[model samples]
Target: MRRLLNDLKIMLLANFWLIPVIALLVGALFYFVAPPPPMHAKMATGAATGGYHAFAERLRDELAKEGFTLELVESRGSLDNLGKLLAGDVGLALVQSGQELTLSERQRGDLFGLGVMYREPVWLFVRTPVTFQRLSDLADLRLAIGSDGSGTQAVIGALLAANRIEEGAYPENWQRIGGSRAANALIAGELDAAFFLGPAENALIQRLAAEPELRLESLNRTRAYLARLPYLSAMEVGEGMLNMPMDTPAKDIVTLGPVATLVANEDFHSSLTPLILEAARKVLENGSLLDPPDSYPAAPPRSLQTLDEAEYYYNKGLPILQRYLPFRIASLADRYIILAIPLLVLLFPLFKAIGPLYQWRIRARIYRWYKHLREIDLQLYKGEWPDDLDAEIERLEQLESEMGRIEVPLSYSNELYQLHVHLRYMIERLRTAQKRRQA
Candidate 1:
């Protein structure tokens, strides 16, 4: 151990600059290859009672169980959620599907989805029976199209515009009250029709579905809607799906809806993706409204593209390392696992070459004294040995003393011993020559 350390000391002293340079290189590697995982993250959710908000709370609680804190910031709706994510107010948010496709290249580059958490069916409730087969029939009636910035308003607005209803043929017909309020207004004879974009579990949605006077519109133009709005899909609610006991709806109701996707800033912490996704699985997998069991958390959401992690997760599922280890450690391992390959390539050669280089350095020191010894031996053989015999003896004695104090690693001790033997032999030859000259 001591000998090995001595060799390392000598090698490093001879090439001391490498220490800091390598340290700097390692630091840069860690900086680029192994960023620390975020301890906490914030998500921009919707109104307190909205589906997005509820999903966020469940996610927060799930993450908290694993010692991670997820803060939920309430916003108006999907539009507001998108705004917060872009402005960097939060790391993630629940956005209505399809809105992300409207962003510019720069905006798209800044955002990505984890996956579609669940489908949010766009529901149209009418007090009267489906007298009209189209959305145009409800134009003259008093309607609530949800809050101004809500996904319900955005989708309904598009449908209204396509049907030429937004051309101001009926200016006083619509109101901007949100889901719970709209449900109440419809029951009180204030609203003839209303739209809500959420799961059936919402109290307002549940009550509206159970209302005897009100009827749910199937939006018979669902195919045409999907043709124009690729983000939405045709959805069907089964007869007993809402309330099995009440057999709410009494029949299947076809509708149009955009699924709700869990989106995040592109720079959001990579480690949290799978963790939140797994948590989403627990909450959204039971399905909602129109979805069947295990129907949600779909990869490559219909509207926006997803992070590559989501692609990997969907295709391959969670990493094996994450399955065996804690999330933080596993994430760190995954981050640097690629880095570890290159680092190993770098360090293996350096470590393999070190011992030889160190030995060469040790040999160089011994070679210096050997060079002087060679010159002295040649001089002693060529001339009358007694002329500078005393001086030569003194020179040999000094060489021996100097060599005694010299150090090398124990592995090279054999070479050092050979050097001592040569010195002693030279001294003896010099004395023999002196005696012969005197005789």
Candidate 2:
């Protein structure tokens, strides 16, 4: 045992360069491997008082439970959010589904999306006694089509342009206001009509429905607008959908808008995609007036490419480990898996190499003693028995005793036995010489 340990120590010291070389290689590998998920995610949501903001807050609160925090940046609306995302200022944003954004190849390359969360409709609410016979007819009247950079204004422009109606250099009666303020203006007779791209649950939409003086216009040209744009979809506010007692929205009101897409920057970490999708399912899967049951999180990403992680989650569900482990732990395992595969392939041979090297080290210790025994036999064969013949015999006997005292592991016991046999032969020759000298 002592001989083997001493030899093993020497072998390792001889190849000490392996230690630092392997460490450097591993360090460089880590630079390319996927990093651990960051603790925080930044998102661009619409107006602070808008539905997008409320949805973002709900999502942020849910993420906190999994040790992930969400940073919400308030903006004018989807257009502003898109600008922030494309600029790399934020990793996530809520973008309205319609409007074929004029993206350069570079911009398009960095755009990806999670699925739609819910539906948002473009409502054209007009004051009482100023009914809409057709969309083109109202272009000459007072209209409030949301403020600049808002999803409402963007969608309204697309709808108008599709209808062959272009904004004049100065449309005399056109006004720009927030959706809620526009609704208020229409109610006070300050505007003839207001355009809003909001979900059914929006406070202004609900408030306007309750007002007797305000009425939702039936954009009877929904099919025409839908034909002109692929992203736009026709929706209807059912009669008495808001309040059965008040019989609000007295009749079916046809409208058009695009779905709300959950978009992420191209470089956003893939691990975070599932978390946000799951959060969306938890927050919106329940049936709302606009959000249908079991409709969120799994739908195709609207107006953008579907994120690969979200596609995996929708198809395979949480990975087997993630289903059992907490999110943080599961995420760690997932990240390591990419590295572990190649690492295992590499380290398996390194570990295998160690066993053979260890065996060689132990065997070398046993062979070294044999070399000494051969040299001693060669010297004694000269038949020289000096006056110190007894002393010479004693020395040979001590050598045999020393050989027996040295320990070897059981697996190498045969080598130890061979060593002892050689020692005995040397001792017999030494004693024979002593006897000859006595004669």
Candidate 3:
């Protein structure tokens, strides 16, 4: 055991060149590898009770399982969320699909689309017995077009403009109020009709659906609206979709609405796209009442530039490593695993040379003695002896003694023994010659 340990120590010392080589390899690995994706990010969600905020909460919970923290910042609504994303106030935001129309070329250039989360239907709830045939019909009645910077207001404005109902033509009683306040006012008869945008399951939408005095109005010109606003999807709401028992709406209703798209600005890390989208997929996997399973988180309609990572995710599932390993481990592996190929390419030749290098190093310890032996042999072959033959033999005797302390691997012990024999032979030859000369 001790001999084996000593051999190992010698072998290790012989490969001292590996230290710097490995150091350089490690430095290159770090220099080439991409920085790990952040484990924390902020999302601009909507009002505390709004659908965007609700979905963001579920998404946050899903990401937490992977040790990622998703901070949800409350905003007024989708338009406000988009503004926050543009200003770089947050890494991500949920914007109503058609809201992209409001962005300038420069503003759109700075943003990227992750995907759509779900639909936000444009709902028009009117007080009972209020005759409403077209959007122009609302010009003479009280209405809630949604608050400023809210998705509700944006969609309603577009619909009204498409009908050629200019803002100046709207009734003086029209207000920019929505959510619970709009639901309450419509119930109290303060407004003849109110426009809201949210999923059927939103608390306010559900509450309003249950009210007997309110009529959930279905539009007749949905095809026209869809033609004008390409980003809007035509959604079907069955008679009892909101509340089957109550038979809310009392008839099937067709409506036009925009999807809620997940947007990120330039400052957002592209690497996190898969992680965020995967978490969102989990949130929408079960599907809602109106949306079918796996229907959403689809690529945001072609109006926006999709992040490359997000596009990869939608085409292929999670990255190979992320599917089997924890996120932190998977992410690190994903970024640096490719580096292994190049590193191996470099190390293969280096390791291949080690064997010969080690052999030369071990053999050098034995071969150096041959130089002295060869010189004495050549001098004797020419019938010449050193001036002081006795002193020359004494010097060779010292070398032979020192050979005992020299160590080489057992595999090369034969060469060492041969060196010993040559040294002894030289000493004996000089001694024999010395006696003859004295006699």
Q: Among these predicted structures, which one has the highest TM-score?
A: 3
RMSD of each: 3.5, 4.2, 2.0
**In model 3, what is the error at residue 407, expressed in angstroms?**
1.4
Give each model's whole-structure lDDT.
Answer: 0.80, 0.77, 0.89
- Which runs in model 2 stand beyond 4 Å of their true positions? 1-32, 298-303, 350-355, 377-398, 433-439
Q: Could you tell me the TM-score of candidate 2?
A: 0.86
How far residue 27's Cα lies from its native spot in candidate 1, in Å, is: 3.7
| Worst window of 10 by summed lDDT in candidate 1 | 162-171
lDDT of 2 by residue, 44-104 (tens): 9988778888889888998888888999998988888888988999999988885326567
- lDDT for 193 in candidate 1 is 87
TM-score for candidate 1 = 0.86
Candidate 3 lDDT tens digits, 1-439: 9889989988999889899998999899998788888898899998998899889989999999989999999999877888899888999999999788788988888889999999889899998889888988887789999988899988898999998887787778899898889888899989899999999999989998889888888888888888888888899999889987778878999989999999999989898888888888888999998999888788876878988898889899788888898889988887777888889899999999999999999999889988988999998999898889988999999999999999888888999999988899999999988998999
Estimated TM-score per prediction? 0.86, 0.86, 0.94
Ten contiguous residues with the weakest lDDT in model 2: 99-108
